[model samples]
Target: MGYSRLNVVIRADASVHIGMGHRVRSEVLAEAFSEQGAEVCFVVHASCADFSKEGDFVFGSESEWHELAHQADILVLDHYGYDAAAINALFQLNPNLLVLDDNNNRGDFNCRWLLNPLSLRYSETVQFPLTGGQCAQLRPQFSKYRAVNPIGQQKLLLTFGGTDPLELTLPFIKSLFVKGFPTEFLLIMVGSGVQNAKEIQDYCRQHHMECQIGVNQVSELMAQSRFAISAAGGTLFELACMGVPTHFIQVADNQKDALAEHSALGWCSATDFTGCLPKQRVSLIDKVVESVLKTWQTDLTQRSQLARECVDGLGAWRVVETVLASRLVK
Candidate 1:
């Protein structure tokens, strides 16, 4: 079952507003497809064209999407901007449509398959054979860097997605300092879309703390960190794969349900800070930092074990095998 003849076209986008989770996960699947000898191409929005590779396509209109779909053997869509009508139109162009979704909130999808790695719940109407965190698409680096003993250094990794649209990094770091958390142990990762990177870098320098902007080797950092304070997005699953105990925060409306679900599963702890007033936000941050310090003092063996048990770092391979095995691939 060589995939040398198959062509996989992935449609996703990233920007300062929407973040890079979609593009990152799409790349994970793309790598898996490439490993199987499939020809992979990315179709991103014009705003994110700068991030595209040599053979990638930048599409600005729905008609442009249809044009790409007409040529693809399998069109993998991971964008939130597409509506049910738009998805159905792509299905008309090519029936082998695989939609990567977070939630099944959209009325209905006429695609051949749907993959949602965050939630386990599946609608009776839709064909959601692939669900749950086991399907979480993570890069191969995470598996390679997975901590064997699940015990890490004293450093605490902090990431707020690729954009940090709410601008939570500096305020959160400041809150940690004000809450008596040691500044020397903080390892801040500033995303490419973070508008206040200069300010954050200056603050880190003044405090003599470490900060990295648009880092490529994130798995190396995660492998060395004892714990993390991350946004409730794809990074949570990545941390889980690395067996890092994390306290996650919801930064967007779409992340709310997934955060709650992951918390209930004991994969990670939650810190509710969204939609708070300025004064209340400060209070919540102080409380969360205090709680984090307390949790750090205790043994995190159970937390790490639970996280690793849920995400085994083979999700991308699982998804690739499923897609290649499907009847639609022909």
Candidate 2:
């Protein structure tokens, strides 16, 4: 409730099902708005509230979407759980609708602003009856990020998003330990989709990689880490903007093209997961550790610079302004 005049509402959700990237990005934009003197309220499904990214006033009820929208100058939706009717419900009450759509599924939303950042590889995900310009690639608001300070090469960040369903995170940590990678401070981010917290705990003890699971302060961890081993989803952009060198894993087919395209451009490295079994995936962790340390030892300056240039930030800020501008025009 930092703003005295405007109330901005962000409706997004994170689950073991939809994954954490959705909420992570939503939080990024909402926190930015909060710092700019906006009272940001988040409307989410009750079951998904506990896993939601921090900050903002929270409303955990599906029936509350329109009600919350009525109180805001802008409504930002970043979840796939809702379809056209759910989204239109909010739009019916407010002229401004900002949707963070992946897959370009809702390419036709009747809204003021629509974000299809980096475009969507899974066309069916957003090729819906919704009407709005498909414009997710309109640049991000990384410059407007509310996080302070930066990671001066202390720890390594590992985030595989929502499920970590493959149980890949802790296995990788053990590989790092076996390979004797520096364990001064390792921050591991996972989602409820992963039921292996206990296993992660035991492995961390065995190798003592200062790693933890299910961290809520993921941005803070990214800001603190020297580099990252991440799934090629939303976090890729965040890591690039943070200037953290990254090695990517495609956890799903939905993410294949983005990962491959970015890797080919040297924005990051891609480890193919197609038809790769779980045990085989574990072995790849060894390759990741080896590759990471080797890259650091050989040429780091070029890597960091590349990452910084790929995502210069400001995406969320641009999105917010776009929505607001559309509202003003009407």
Candidate 3:
């Protein structure tokens, strides 16, 4: 926890418009940076936002172009809404800025380091019209904070979002119950920010589907599981890296492409939640859960390959090491 002082500022252009991957990955990156003794801060757009963090200097409202950049050795931008002008708005004040993007549109960025660690399939998404110094193309690195090598029962996690605001869990889990599948526990990680946690809990109890909401002990719970059924986003990467084989379901449109791609490669099975499922939602969940269970049991070989290729569990460390080793101040 002790090292050289590092003021790392991250820009995440997230809102109700964008889903939660950017902020989530940014937070994970910040946690990695913190492990190396960096003081991390995040600059978010001025909107009705609920995301929060400790030791995080939250900047917003007027979108203060604070001299925090001058203090920070690294200014990493993970936003999607911001184009060159938006990046320029911040970077003009601090010339030594590094941008981390996946969409591959860093057009004429004064970027010292341009990172796109996505796989070859995703390369097209990020292959910009222009070019710059490619950033650290990382091997998969699992999170140090998360559970490693399973020590307990299979932790089945169902995290749609920090806030599954739709109250979709009851119908979703009820569908699983109707299937009468053999499974130990189903952990439903929820954010209190979402108002439907209570409704989800009562429904879980009624159906005898073991469920727990609230964001406590998730990483540990996930580690204990032999397999996971989760949304295809940053969590998919984390689960694969942790060696927790997953039955991935895309809960959003953006996730569908990634899920399909990752599933095609045997990383995770794709059961999407983005379409109209008639009026019979429970029936659909049952069908999906059954499919997930079947694939999870018999598809170990593919899953193992997926675990290897997606993330070897060292990506966090590698990125941090790159950040530290690439320090210009030294």
**RMSD of each candidate relative to the true structure:** 2.0, 5.5, 4.9
Stretches off by above 4 angstroms in model 1 are 123-128, 277-280
- Consecutive 10-residue window with the lowest summed lDDT within model 2: 129-138
lDDT score of residue 303 within candidate 3? 61
The whole-model C-alpha lDDT of candidate 1 against the native structure comes to: 0.83
Angstrom error at residue 120, model 3: 5.1
Candidate 2 per-residue lDDT, tens place, 1-330, comes to 234467778777777766767767677777667666777777777677667545544565566556777767777787777777767766777766677665655444555665655533433322222321222221234443424455356677877776776777877777777777777767677655687877777766776566656665455567677777887777777677766778888777767756755676575787877678866877777887899878656545567667766665666556555444343423
Evaluated at residue 71, the lDDT of candidate 3 is: 63
lDDT of 2: 0.65
Which ranges of candidate 3 are over 4 A from the true structure? 1-5, 13-20, 54-63, 105-108, 120-155, 183-185, 275-286, 296-302, 327-330
Instruction: For candidate 1, list the clashing residue pairs, or say none.
Output: none
> What are the lDDT scores of the predictions, listed in order?
0.83, 0.65, 0.60
